[model samples]
Target: MNIRPSAAIRQNYNEIADMCRKTGEPVFLTKNGEGDLVVMDIGTYNRREKMLKLREELLAVEEDRMRGSKGYSVEEVTAMMRNAIREAEGHGTAE
Candidate 1:
């Protein structure tokens, strides 16, 4: 919900950069009263991108489920997770 004129990027770059870093949000820039660009810190931008990609993957999984894709039961998933944890911890295999 942060909005600023495009010129503010040039005139007050440091302030805008600080706001983005502190808030982890994007600043909307308007050119001639119209939406022009968005500015955000690199870490926030990367995290947002990662979230979007995760959402897309979840959506795809949902679509596959809707199409009758195979899925593991809760017990099977739990056992798989246990095995993975055991392997990661170098404790040999889960029984």
Candidate 2:
């Protein structure tokens, strides 16, 4: 983990942002000897957020399956989503 004191952020904001952009990794900012915050470029932050959301969804699905809930396979989910889109667009179901 790339770590820097919070004062470094106040003093070298541009350099720190540049490092985050170039490295595509978060910079850990510490305050008073404790972990404070993380800084990352916008693109990296968006991608990380999307990945985390997908992981959460996967975990939910796994838990549901473990509880004996009927789960759609990827292909079934894709087909259902496509059909829904078609219906929303006023196109009749292709099935």
Candidate 3:
């Protein structure tokens, strides 16, 4: 949800923004003119705007998992991961 305010709104932007955040609303601001120009509380606005992106990424990852995306089983994955750690720790090839 976004809101647009005239330039006058800037006089009390912080006050209005606090209210908006509390109410889960948004305020769009503009110069001393009509219609909206500047988006308000844009940090939250951007993050909320990316919600679909995040959800889509998660969904795609889940779909990949469902399609057997991994080349190794759990045990194999864990061992491979542990082996990598060991190799990194200067403990090459415990075998």
Clashes of each: 0, 0, 2
Where model 1 places Cα greater than 4 Å from the true spot, the runs are: 78-95
Least lDDT summed over 10 consecutive residues: which range in candidate 2?
Answer: 86-95
Model 2 segments more than 4 A misplaced = 73-82
How well does candidate 1 score on lDDT at residue 28?
Answer: 100
RMSD of each: 2.3, 2.4, 4.9
Question: lDDT tens digits, residues 1-95, model 1?
Answer: 89999999999999999999999999999999999999999999999999999999999999999999999999999999999999999998899
Give per-residue CA lDDT, model 3, range 1-95, as digits (tens): 45555754767777877766676666666555555664446666777879978999999989999999965789887888888988999999555
In angstroms, the error of model 1 at 16 is: 0.3
Task: Check candidate 2 and list the clashing pairs.
Answer: none
Candidate 3 worst ten-residue window by lDDT: 31-40
Superposition TM-score, candidate 1 onto the true structure: 0.78
lDDT of 2: 0.95
Clashing pairs in 3: 3-26, 3-28
TM-score of each: 0.78, 0.79, 0.42
Sort by TM-score, best first: what order?
Answer: 2, 1, 3
